[model samples]
Target: MAVARRRHREPHFVDVALRHRFLRHAHRDVQRRRIPLPIRHPGGPQVKLLYDWLTKEQGKDVVVTREPGGAPIAERIRHILLDPQNKGMDPKTEALLYAAGRAQHVSDTVRPALERDAVVICDRYIDSSLAYQGLARGLGEDDVLHLNEWATDELLPDLVILLHLEAERGLERLEGDPDRMESEDVSFHRKVGEAYVHLAREYPSRFAVVDASGTKEQVHTQVRAAVLPFLAPDRVET
Candidate 1:
């Protein structure tokens, strides 16, 4: 007799959202001292108290191991790219750090969430590295793709949500907190945009482009529409 195969059913939107909320809480609890994670919606007073307890009730001495979150990875990559010492570092080394950080992040954060049936919303992933580092080091597209595949160990996102903002608009959004990478020359951002467009063209099924030039509500609407199929049965088109 043939062995029976178990089919894995996809999680509903609300379930995924709740799981994401828990993961966000865990992530924020880990980094309470550094930067506070933004809450997507206002919760009851109990939730607030819970958040505070997670931060304070747990003794500061109780070390939560540092996981490779997307924000930290981006910050680290920006530092490495801008470091004068890195000017002498070969392209392979540069690529290695990115791959290492990504692997650690996926292993620590993303993989766990996926296992628990949560939808992972990342700030940036392989595509960003492919565009930024690949262009910066003059690595060809093939090499970039190969490096990303090796680095991520071929773990791919179910959907890649690209916030398509005009270069000027994206720069404007970064005006308040001008990090080294955020403050890069407009020309570079333009190239990044171009690369993103190329990537989308090359992988249309995986990529969903959202007009991020609009207000938060507008952008959210667009993103919601794009995500509706996976989110709700009613939203799915026959």
Candidate 2:
């Protein structure tokens, strides 16, 4: 049964029926779908945390994880990559390391969950590398995309939600000493933002742009609206 949110015109008969069907068999009807929130903005972690809570409220039977550290092997790679001490890391090396972690994550964590018919909600994925290294670090977009293809065997998220805000505002939201990527200059992050926007435009079907400057609740509302249409097969007029 198809489902849609009730609106001012009142729930359609199909909507009512689908909701009834869902309520009657909520535990059994959950389908496997990948939902990745690309934390492109500095304020995005808060949005991601809030959305995990929102997941429970939605009863979508989704499992949440983060890139570079979702699985055991990937976590080790994460430590190496995120270590601030690794300041001298080369761009090509950084791209390869990210792919290595992602490959492990897909094989050991993400793919398995999806096979089990569970929705896997990830905090970040290939796009992060594409924005950080491919565009910002001059690693070449095609090369980065090819690297990721080898890593995940061309696996793509069902939906990519980009939390977008201006670079300076996002930087202001940071706390303490910044990490390697975070420590980059404002112009670097501005380029990263442009890269993200480019990806959104380049892949509109898979990308949803959400304003990240709003309060947590406001952002979450937009997040839900962006994904709900994809989640429910029913025709959503809005």
Alpha-carbon local distance difference test for all models: 0.49, 0.67
- After superposition on all C-alphas, the RMSD of every candidate to the true structure, in Å, is 11.7, 8.7
- Judge candidate 1 against the unseen true structure and give its global Cα lDDT, from 0 to 1: 0.49
Model 1 agreement with the true structure over 1-238: per-residue lDDT tens digits: 0001212223311111211212221121231101111111111222233233333542111111121235466457647755654446676676667777777666666656555443344555666666666864467666876776666555544455577767777676552556445556888888878887787777675567766666565665665555544432332332
Error of 1 at 136 (Å): 5.6
Q: Write the per-residue lDDT of candidate 2 for residues 109-228, one digit (tens) a residue.
A: 877765555556678898888888899889888899878866776665545678889999989988888877677889988999999999888877667788989987788777667656
Where model 1 places Cα greater than 4 Å from the true spot, the runs are: 1-68, 71-92, 175-177, 232-238
Error of 2 at 217 (Å): 0.9
Clashing pairs in 2: none
